[model samples]
Target: MTPKIVIFDWDGTLIDSVDHIADSLHLAATELGFPALERDAYKDIIGLGIIEALQTLYPGLAMDEIQAIREGYGRYFFSKQTTPQNVFAGISELLAELAGANAQLAVATGKSRRGLARALESSGLGAHFAVTRCADETRSKPDPAMLMEIVEHFGIEPGEAVMIGDTIYDMDMAQRIGMPAIGVEWGVHPRARLEEFAPAAVASDMAALRQALYLA
Candidate 1:
């Protein structure tokens, strides 16, 4: 069946911003007098929002400290690194193919609404997505609320849309809503880690992701 709409995960799926994220997290942690997260540890927190990520990283910290760290991370991430985020190779081509196929597009991300908007505008992908649901619009990843919001906003059913992302949160949220998910391997999370969510299919690269989306 043809997909009526396509929902994308912003950060690691379409944009290669893991390095920026790690940098911000590291800077924030250091500023807060906490240990910087190791690379592997950062990978494990890819899909969650900043608040959740901070909680996971410094669970022993007091609530106020956690809030402060989250605030610091947000400020640095948006002001310092967002503009430098580059789109993954072939992602633009794939998105073009999907758009040419008349598939409505949207974004569901753990990023804040303002941050996602800035990233898209800076990256020249703002016009491509008809709707964008960020952390401020709904609960964080794995909640299914954002995905559900996207579906409703676009007037499409779960089965009529596919959620494409690079993390388990994306896959599991799609599963919860009975939507097919196309998992990409080159993002923050590795293939082995993504497989735990039982995605409908896994794509090793943008070319393969196009095929999974029935655009190739």
Candidate 2:
């Protein structure tokens, strides 16, 4: 059955911003005199909240160090250019198709409120979403808090909603709350990794994703 509400993850799933994000994190860490890991290392933490990502990347970080890295990351991230072109090809059409089918669209992202706002504005995709929840506003992914809130906001049961994302965090959160999840291969995590979370389906591209959502 087609879900009434479809919640999307912002960075890797909707837009092609993973490389840019990884770059920003590397620059930030390097600026702070911390050794930056490979791009894949940063990519692994893409769906987590900033603080959580930082903690995971550099465990045992002092509070002050975390704050410093956060500031540095923000500076580098915003300094880069972003446009509607960054949105994955066919995403706009896919979103429109979902809305046309009477499915409510929303965003559940690891980005901060300000960061998401900027991306939404720049991408011109904000109008497509019925609502959005940022990492800073609630418990991060794999926790189910954000997804639960989105479900409540729409006055629907967890089973009536579906989450679409590129990371295992998205899958784990949905699974924890009895919501179906669809994973995209184009995102940070590999198909095998996402499969471990038992997603309803793992899509390799937009066409496959649409089919997973019953839109095809």
Candidate 3:
């Protein structure tokens, strides 16, 4: 890969926390007396920011209800998750290898700054990334603004950066800037769905993802 910077999505790309997220959404809905949803309803919005995810999850809900679900979900998720999220296989190695290669690594995630901070602190890999952009700070995924900001921060051209993620949102954002993007299969979105956004490739596993990043 000729790209000097590699941008990664957090939740499903680096860690397997969709199940917990879905569970938290479900519990929050139940506690708030909201209508029950089908299995994995929350999972469908895994790559979106919390506000966007909540809106997508409950489209008809009033703003007040949306806020309620958001707060409830946050409370439930943090309370139940005492341990650090389970990092995906080969993810740690991938980050270390990327850094070792002098490729700048950064996160452009839908997670809040606080949430990302918590994960980074617990993972003990915060220093691995040179920069990070959160949904709370910028427009959500599928929007190219954050990608633009990152490249600007590094003073690199869009062609010199690649976005690695598991969702169409990530692919779309990078694609909008005419940047190369790689998708991972072991995440919330299916490979077929991620391909719809025209990612360069969608790896079925971490080894393939490493190869896609040219880090292996």
For residue 17, model 3's alpha carbon misses the true position, in angstroms, by 0.4
lDDT of 2 at 208: 95
TM-score of 1: 0.93
**Candidate 3 to native Cα RMSD, angstroms:** 1.5
TM-score for each candidate, following the candidate numbering = 0.93, 0.98, 0.94
What local lDDT does model 3 show for residue 116?
86
RMSD list, candidates in order: 1.7, 0.8, 1.5
The candidate, 2 or 3, that scores higher on lDDT is 2
Question: Candidate 2: lDDT over CA atoms?
Answer: 0.94
Report the C-alpha lDDT of model 1 over 1-216, residue by residue, as the tens digit.
448999999888888887778787888789877876677787667778767777787787777887787788787788754443388877777778778889888999988787887888888888889988887668888899998888888777898899999888899899998999988988877788778888878999877877787766
Candidate 3 lDDT over 96-204, as tens digits, reads 8887788998899998888888888877668888999998899988788888999999999988999999888899899999999999988888988889988888999
Q: Looking at candidate 2, what is the lDDT of residue 112?
A: 97
Which runs of model 2 end up more than 4 angstroms from their true locations?
none
Poorest lDDT segment (10 consecutive residues) of candidate 2:
79-88
lDDT of 2 by residue, 1-216 (tens): 568999999999999999999999999999889986978899999999999999999999999999999999999999975798998999999999999999999999999999999999999899999999999999988899999999999999999999999999999999999999999999899999999989999999999999999988
lDDT against true structure, model 3: 0.84
